[model samples]
Target: MTSAVTTDNSARPGYGQLLRTPGALGFVLPGFAARLPFGMLTISILLLVQHTTGSYGSAGIVAAVTGISMALSAPLMGILTDRFGQSAVLVPVVLAHAAAVGGLAALALADANVWFLALAAVPTGASVPQVGPMVRARWAARLEGSPLLPTAAAFESVTDEFTFVVGPVLATALCTGVHPAAGLVTEATLTLLGGLLFAARRASQPRTHAPSATGESRSFALSHPGLQVLILAFLGIGAVFGGMQVSLAAFSAEIGNPGANGLLYGVFAAGNMIAGIAMGAVAWKIGPRRRLILGYVGLTAAASVLWAANSVILLGALGLVVGLFIAPALITGYTMVEQLVPANARTEAFTWLTGSIAFGQAVAVILAGRLTDAHGSAYGFLVPMAATALALAVLLALRAKLAPKAPSRIVNASVSAPVSAAAPVSTSAGASAPGSEAAAGPRDRVNERGMGHRVPVTVD
Candidate 1:
């Protein structure tokens, strides 16, 4: 049995090899930097709305609206990127985001109509996905089947940590010190710059899914027993995160130290980022399936601790402890998603996984806000914890009934992929020929029952 699977496309860069090369890290840094400003924008909006409107309730409404809109649009954008390519899709989206956000910033300064302000919010908010998940996808295929992939996951998570940590501090400072509008302007500028830089990156730019890639794989991704469980787990994860956002924000506000809340959120991200690194460094000797089960269970345990106490300090502390498990769990699940999905739908599969995360974050934010309004932030913790716990139990119960993760990689086909001057094949709603026929290149469908894209090893 092969210990590791290699992709059929030798031309594709491995994540491990890319990092080893000089300047590759530098190449990816801009994408990371682009996310920093927006982090501040999110919280600044929350604080600004609360202060200006004198309503934490209104702030929650705006926050929920923004988070949910982004969540709803993300998969669509992912699908667009998968269909149209990142450069084409994200460029226009980012530009629209810039205009919308800039309009909002200006509106904050001007006495703009309230309805107009809300109108602008939606499009600006939609712009967020430009630099986030899609950028991660760019590197995913580049680093497939290497230790670097986990390291890459860690790196991606770190950017998320940095964004939350830095963005909030800036938002808080600008809101209290200068003007709320300053934070908005700062966010607008940063998001525009980051989005532009990321979209412009030649390699990082999103590309359309090659047709013939997945003409036959949607059923597998949607109906495969293992995948179904994973998707449900992700849906629950979304609910947990959505709840966390509202709960954390409200909790911080109630304590009269909103700064502390940002710190707590930062710590939450930090724990995951750090753990993700360690998780990536060590190769799980166990199979991907076993790794996923352990990872999810760890997440359930870590997240549940928030319910034990409402003490701000304690929650923060527990949040960090819980966050420690998050990145690893996500990375493991992402890898599992890759393994479980058919290659034709790899982009969509990955999108589904990422979309689930965003969805979880969105729903959690909305629920947490409402729950905080009705009860308290502390109680909101139960929202995500309970949801995740239930999802886990259900997934576990059904795990055996679902197809097990293929113990070892399998390829029953004798196939060869073509190189240059690739022929283009169009696909339709129910087409399989395009994806199947195109399923041989670096663009080949991920083998659901296989480890990943496999290149047979020959012993001389």
Candidate 2:
């Protein structure tokens, strides 16, 4: 149970170890299916509404509504899952989501009013399953107290990159090649099937915490100072994604290659996937705050180059550079949220991260669309640059507060905590490190099943 903050891939478990965890695949495969629609929905809706209504402005509004709804609902769903367990909540939510998608498709096909389409987005977005957060929570629960936890987190980041790479392309192909309605229909079908399969995997489900145990007067997870900073920072990152999508789409259309947007984005995801896999396998000595700052720097620097991209080839090449920091940033954030809050608030805390990104993206799309529509695609890149700059500033200002405190020495401690590569190992008094029983108070050490576990100390 020794810590490996400075260890390389040779010292860590192989990628296979992530799947070898009991019941890992049962949740992961369906989770992937459920998440695929995230990539599809925004672009598909953008194209579909724009095509039918004859205006990108109308399409952007509807899409923005959908994204905002999804973002707003994330924390609520997280609370629900934390209180009642995943299966109990997922069944109803997923079915309702499928139904909403069906209605949205029918309305789009019938040339319904633009406001009517926006109305449909409310339920469609609200019903998005807590799949991403759930999958991460499941991994944390299963791998609780294991040194391999960070490795698992990295694997999940890679999975996310892969989904983004394929999901948007799939959406675009369905909307363009097959039929406009095809993308929405496929999204609904996949979500339903995946949600059902995920629900059936009882073995992999994480333990649930009753909200009442925290007492009615307890502060929400976001009330914590560090978590607040992280959420705000993530908002900037989300804006980066949202603004880039709009810019790429407009740029493609301007270049007489509207369909190339998905491929360009895929190039972006490919770079992220490659970097994410390697990031997960290696161990780091630097703390999470430093890594987070570095990621911000890299993302901003690479994204700044987009303003100069006049051709699709240049955009594709720059996409790879912009993607390099995404995985490191995301993986580190997830790992930190796991340790920053109490065990009971784990799911809800993660959902806050999701919601932050959603809100940021929602704002970005709305702003970027108008910017691109008024000026040109070239101006659209400015939105992400501003967003990343703000993020970097936030991290720099809060670097000391956000960094984990050094861990305290213990006499013959039984458990070693797992450390995310993005975060440094805490060794000071009251330091909060992942899976550290000493760092977590008595109530925080208990599992969802009302059982307490001892800390597994590392020999090294």
Candidate 3:
């Protein structure tokens, strides 16, 4: 019976089961709306600053400054969320973000100095809510020991890709068809309203606990060598995003149809979303660590040819391929946090990964923008290829560090059974244990804190 159950694909829980978990929809809906601005803000800034300054270089600098600020501040915000709880940290942050966005838009429209615009960007980006990470933390808490954790990670990635699809299109349409500043205004509005609504879902927010007696709380997420590798790899992914955004816009402008930037970007993001959906649905036999390396290799391969795409159709097709390969890498990274970090630091860990992407994007945006301005949009494509290749090398060198430092043990409370640390947990249905890399699903088991409930625990 156990063998039959393990072999039967139908026994695995689907996305519907994951979503039906209590209080999931309450936060997921508002969380989706809040994060739309994540995709909008940078593009809107690039377009608006370019419109005002008449230089892609200048626009890129401002956008890059914003990305850098976000990268620097995200982990700090995560620490606050972990210490003070999500709603308490988010309410003030969102309010500040809205105000800063308004000020940045005003300065640009008023033809303020580039330095002033850049300075204003600091607060704007710093205060932008880390909605994506927060939401994922909530999922981590709600589905801690469940098999649905990987599905949740994939679902969040899909949500992110969907927003990217809609955000660029909306921002581009508003800026081109309505007014240059319209996109920024709309982005600010959504950030404020959606952020507040998402913050108000306190019932679903992860509980923030006080520090343990051992002073374990002082440990930062980056202290883990494995997490550092993941961050570096994600930075490369960020380069892909930054490279594509500027290059796509520059290409569209070069072709005498600037409005097409949104459409092209949308197609790229649609591929990512589709892949996320597929990744979540599959019961994978391969480990996430191996899957991550494979996904990134494919992404790097697809990115290598982006410089050769001269036509809109060709660029879009190449971009689609790049997008398809990115989702697995991203989902795997997020899923791996459960095994690498303690529950208390999971939120901060997620933010570190996110911040690395922002930092990478910032660097790429400036490089790509200058390259596009000097040579052409085609030259900007080199950033992602080089970045991914370099990151892949780092990942390969540190591949051994990606494994969990300690073996995971499952304690079954119903029967008071103690599973061997070196062996897989025996489920009645013979399903491979949640944390085991060999499981026919994504490995997402976290170190359970207590012994009362049946959970996987990893002792460091």
Candidate 4:
């Protein structure tokens, strides 16, 4: 009988190839628009609240509350998405977010009390659509078992960094030049329109799996020990962001150029975007776990000297270095989910990592703001250093936990015959039998079943 099983020996695809995948732009564009507001929200809230209240302390507190709320709510949203599908969860969440943000802006403009503003922030943050996690989940579903999975993860991070580059600059300009509330109003508009557009792309959304007989689908992403480690690592990264946002703004004001806050933060985010782009292009030999650890080492080293920079040029230069090292760790953490979590729990896993960053940022923003107020902007710079140091220590101690519990397997599909009749394929790391049509390339192995392809059987 003619064998229907064949191996694919194709070289790994690049970003261009990944983007060219059919229907990619359908979700990518809308997802980008929806998530751009993520970069803007914190800064917009900080500036608007600080402007109205004339107190950085109150502004920091309000922003912190928002971040904390979002961090807490993200996984819950992920659970809803995993159960009901993305469109159903996103529609109401986006609408609620727009309304909440609008109310917060109105109250800020009306000189509402800090306590009232804090209360409004709860709903505003809880309603922020989990767009980033949703997009990542789409990519995972679309590219499962393909070599381009890492590139997709890197591309997502690049997209995130690009939004940070533009979002802060746009929000700052609107708040400073147009109106104190303009930044927030624009944020709300984008969240509403972009989120609805993203939700409308039903074709690109991942299929929601029904709960298993054992209800394994109902388990939380945080139940995984590896996921917990990743979340803690991400919290450190969030601290960098939170520390940078507040400290950089304070530094700019202290240097008699408050308007330069956007430019400075933009430079930092640009560095991050650049690094992400470069990371996606390279074919690294080291595994993701090693890359993650090394990335943190570089980050901690760079962040250590940030407090000593007394000049704008120096601070910006140091900030750029810090940004440069962030992408590898961030991208690796996202990429690791493929091995660490099952397909059913992937979205929730992504959100936990994302939320931990927000939580870390929330804590750092409050602490950094108080330090800057009490001492100086230089003191605020200490937060990233401390956070990174602690994260690095944890990663070093628990490095083994990051390994996958089960070996990833390559699924061979029979194109011409039923998969059941095809001979069992080797799980080893090379070519099939000598006369086979193609060879199995390393890194092309993944446990992606039920992908709507003409697959006969999957080997465990």
User: TM-scores of the models, in the given order?
Assistant: 0.76, 0.84, 0.86, 0.88
Q: What are the lDDT scores of the predictions, listed in order?
A: 0.61, 0.76, 0.82, 0.83
Tens-place lDDT per residue, model 3, 176-213, is 89999999999989999999999999999888855878
Model 4 RMSD to the real structure? 5.3
Of 3 and 4, the candidate ranking higher by TM-score:
4
- The regions of model 3 sitting more than 4 angstroms off are 1-10, 212-216, 254-260, 409-460
Task: Indicate which candidate wins on TM-score.
Answer: 4
- In the range 355-417, model 4's lDDT, one tens digit per residue, is 999999999988898899899999999999999999999999998888766442334321222
RMSD of 1: 7.9
lDDT of 2 by residue, 43-127 (tens): 7888788878888788888889999999999999998888889999999998999999899888987999999999999999889
Give the number of the best model, judged by lDDT. 4
Ranking by lDDT: 4, 3, 2, 1
Clashes of each: 21, 20, 0, 0
Where does candidate 2 stray beyond 4 Å? 1-11, 211-219, 404-460
Model 3 CA lDDT for position 28: 94
Compared to the true structure, candidate 3 yields what TM-score? 0.86
In candidate 1 the C-alpha lDDT for residue 39 amounts to: 75
Residue 263's lDDT in candidate 2: 83
- Over the full model, what C-alpha lDDT does candidate 1 score relative to the true structure? 0.61
All candidates in order of TM-score, best leading: 4, 3, 2, 1
